[model samples]
Target: MLEPLGVDATCELVYREMLTHPGEGVAALAQRLGLSREDVGIALDQLSSLALVRQSYEPSGRQRPVSPEVAMRILLERQSAELEAHQHRLALSRAAATQLIAEASEAMADPQQVGVELLVGIDRIREWLSQLATEIQGEVLTFAPDGAQTQDNMDASRPLNLGLLQRGVRLRTIYLESIRSDAPTLDHVRSLIRSGAEVRTAPLLPTRMIIADRRLAMLPVDDHDSGRGAVVFSESPTVQALHALFESVWERARVVGGAPPSSKDADLAPQDAAALKLLAEGHTVESIAKRLGVSPRTARRITTSLQDRLGARGRFEAGVKAVRRGWLPMRD
Candidate 1:
């Protein structure tokens, strides 16, 4: 405790001796603690500065140990205030750093070469995305392919997503149909939606991509191996083409969290209805399993159960029966 208060061993010894012998003179404390008089004097000076010891009024040169409670309270309060001051400084530093990075990005970005830039690693890609998010001034469009919205992915994205939304950015995300049955992913999506994001789902997506402000787009260099890094497009033609593809998919995608109009759909659980829709879309069991974040066996089980419930002879027949019964929506 004394160490944290900047009390050295010699000072602590003198303080302890003073505690035992109240109003002890410097020479008396020095002799009692087996320390030289000069050492005791130095310790007294240190303790006095910390409010741990003070000169007695009755004997001007004699020292009295202050109450431990009072001394500790003063030290703790001072430390707390210093900590708060450091926190304020940290906040200002962060603001300054953000401003500097924004200025650097503007300086490095060239109008002639804005169309395409190669991001070489995951760290770099994340940095660029963070920078882009900070600079974004308009709507955000995202397309998430099957098996992409894991809990880890959502966790990593939450901060960036919330930051943009808090700044009044409009976010629209598209996910595969199978995610409707994924509890964790669906929960994350619901949270985003509640925070003013627009979410939709389709049986398939062209690729995983994010288009910000209709001016910039990012997609994996290799869809099968995202570790290959990403390609960012700021060029007009590429961005426009990606935007058009997103719009086409958006038009065909169903709005998540919407009410099921048909009585048959209303009677079934949402996940069950979603599975039926994927089946109608002709997604294979393995593909559905990946999309739903479940094993293929579970996907087959769901398909079999749906077939039995619809009184259909096979998976294809089940799809037809489900459509006729208004349990599955027909594709456009």
Candidate 2:
């Protein structure tokens, strides 16, 4: 029990023995406790460091063990202080994260002198992506919101991805949770995981993105049709902002093929939670289906199921009840 208070078993045993046999020296205590003299000495050293033992008034070098009451009080005070410091640091970090996110949002809404280059058409985008992939030295973060990927897309990406992995580049990708039901996409994800890539899935994503070396970010000009064009941000507020967005989503996303998040969104499945969010946002069935990469029938099924679970008469009531039940996040 005292282990939680930072006292090891040996130290605790020695401390108890010392309390019982106050007049006994280290040798006597060691013999009684069945511990070697060296072990006893080490335990005493640990106790002294913890202030559970103090110098005895006796001329002999033997140390006197502090009373249990005083020792425990000291330990509790130390623990409290450490916890306070930890919380303070966490608060500071939270504030900094909030500031970064706010700045990133503003930057996206109205870009500043942020170094940016717009590449129109699939050919230009692919050319720049290839060039950037070769230049990357550290890591790549990607948000694949396009739902299910085509066989050709997967095949074309393999060589570049494998080359980066061989060069010891860390790659992390977040795909839509809907892809779990798609065999081809799942197989491609598994292959990437086998090659030392980390993959996760989220219910919804804001856009398709790729950030390389924390210095450049690539975003699709149009989410529905990426072939239209792309925007490449280089070492600017916009890139930093996109990185922040990736990190925020990554934290809430679930690991592919792993167990669902425990107790989050009141234990609702990721897809269920996503559906509720979209419903609350007043998205039509068609729009929700497109966003979730599911067919209209499946989207309707999920929506109907949500309404039934919430005992709601319609989509409006379902959204209201979902918010009241804490099953979905509140949006402004």
Candidate 3:
């Protein structure tokens, strides 16, 4: 307490108190702060050394006016200093971003309409997207039928999303109607919207793919094994054709807007509903389990009489016949 008031805590306390009440008395200030008169005096002295404070004696029962000029000038001076600091930081940020964009563009080697390359792992796909994200300045066209981001994936994608947005790229993503049934996924969608993303939804979907600026795109060669050996990054004719196919499919698909579901939807054990729906869509018990966010045994038990109800030869026949019977349209 007696030592040269610590530069850290004391300085903070003095500044806080001065801003709070420049009219407080030494005794009253000490009482309110739970500090001794001597400590307050020391803090004031320390503050005065920085030209951040001024003290003067007045009549015993009188006070010194807190001149508007002094207060406003000090506040403006501090603000100006901070503004200058931020200006420098902004300049550096812009320079570094420009440099990164140049490097990312160069890494692309060649940028032509519809090119594709096979990416073996999730990491490779992420890297391809990250670089493309930085270099793309136009728009991101996304069609995620399966709603593929996990917590770990989102963490990995944070920097990528930020880089794309910072470069003034716009995003328009379409999700599956089923994604609305997952709370965590809904929360993720909210986060994306807050970050300036445009998201939409569709009913039935396949896997996921993205067309970045109509130049390069990501497409899956196989759909069953999502974590399979590889995915394709295409700037090829077939790739563009696939993108156009996706657009056509999307156009025919139902676009789910507001009022599709509520917060209660995630809690509504969709297992039964989804089981029936998938069964009607021609999915086997095992496939239905994964798609409905349940286990295989649960799906099989739930769909035990599905074929009997549909009067079909087997599960596959049951699914095909059920879809033809308009059962796939009942999502609730």
Candidate 4:
């Protein structure tokens, strides 16, 4: 425990030996502790600096151990004062950083220069997103395509999303309907909703995009291969168009928790509905099974059930009938 106060084991041993053999010289203490004379001399220097040991004029200028109670109190007081001073400096640094960031953002806000930056690799995208989330001033709009998010993705996103929410930034998100039955993703969505975010689901989404404060937007450079890289758009017109596309889709999407179950959709469970929506999106039975975490046989059975319920001949007709009956919300 004394190590935290810069007291090493050797120093403690030397001090203990000095305590028992009061007014002992460093050589005598070294012999009692079975340590080298050089080691004992170093320990003596440290203990003296900490006021844990001192050279006594009596007894031929030998060393004497100070009372630990007094020594420890002085060390703690010094530590506390240093900690407070460091904290004060840290706060000032943070304030300066915030001002510098604001100035940099302003400098980069030129309309003539298209702020289209290419971020290569997932690591770069994640890093940029983290920094962008912290600087978001008004709102964050996201179009999350694909199926249910992986646990790793959700874990990575939680801190950034929650930080933005805590800062009073409005969060509006649109997710693919296929993820509606995803337990982990659904749980994460519910938590965000509780934190004042508006979340919705649709049968299909155009692409994965994130727009922050209506000023900047980011989308994968190649939608088919997101790992390739992503493009960041700061041009006002392009960002506005992306924002509009999100709003249009958001208008038609069903609210995750607030939308009341339609009487037509009530006949099917949430997972069943999600499966049907995925099927309607041209997803194969194997892919559907994978997304739903079920067997291929179970996925085929679900399709059969939808076909029977809609009185359709096949998968395509079933999809058409489901759309007509308003049982599934399909993106045009």
* Model 1 regions lying over 4 Å from their true place: 1-114, 261-284, 291-294, 302-332
Q: What is the lDDT of residue 277 in candidate 3?
A: 63
What digit string (tens of lDDT, one per residue) describes model 2 on residues 96-156? 9768755654454454545766677888887887887789999999998867888888987
Assess the local accuracy of residue 22 in candidate 3 as a C-alpha lDDT between 0 and 100: 67
Model 3 misplacement above 4 A: 1-115, 145-148, 221-235, 252-257, 261-282, 291-325, 328-332
Clashing pairs in 2: none
TM-score-superior candidate, 1 or 4: 4
CA lDDT of every candidate:
0.76, 0.82, 0.59, 0.77
Judge candidate 1 against the unseen true structure and give its global Cα lDDT, from 0 to 1: 0.76
lDDT of 1 by residue, 41-90 (tens): 88888888888887777846677888878876665555445444654665
- TM accuracy, model 1: 0.51
* TM-score per model over all chains: 0.51, 0.64, 0.49, 0.54
- Identify the leading candidate in terms of TM-score: 2
Query: Which 10-residue window of candidate 1 scores lowest in summed lDDT?
Result: 102-111
lDDT of candidate 4 over 165-280, digit per residue (tens): 89999999988776666788899999999988999987657678999989999987656577877878885788999989999989978898766667865787665777887766
Candidate order by lDDT, decreasing, is 2, 4, 1, 3
> How does candidate 4 score on lDDT?
0.77
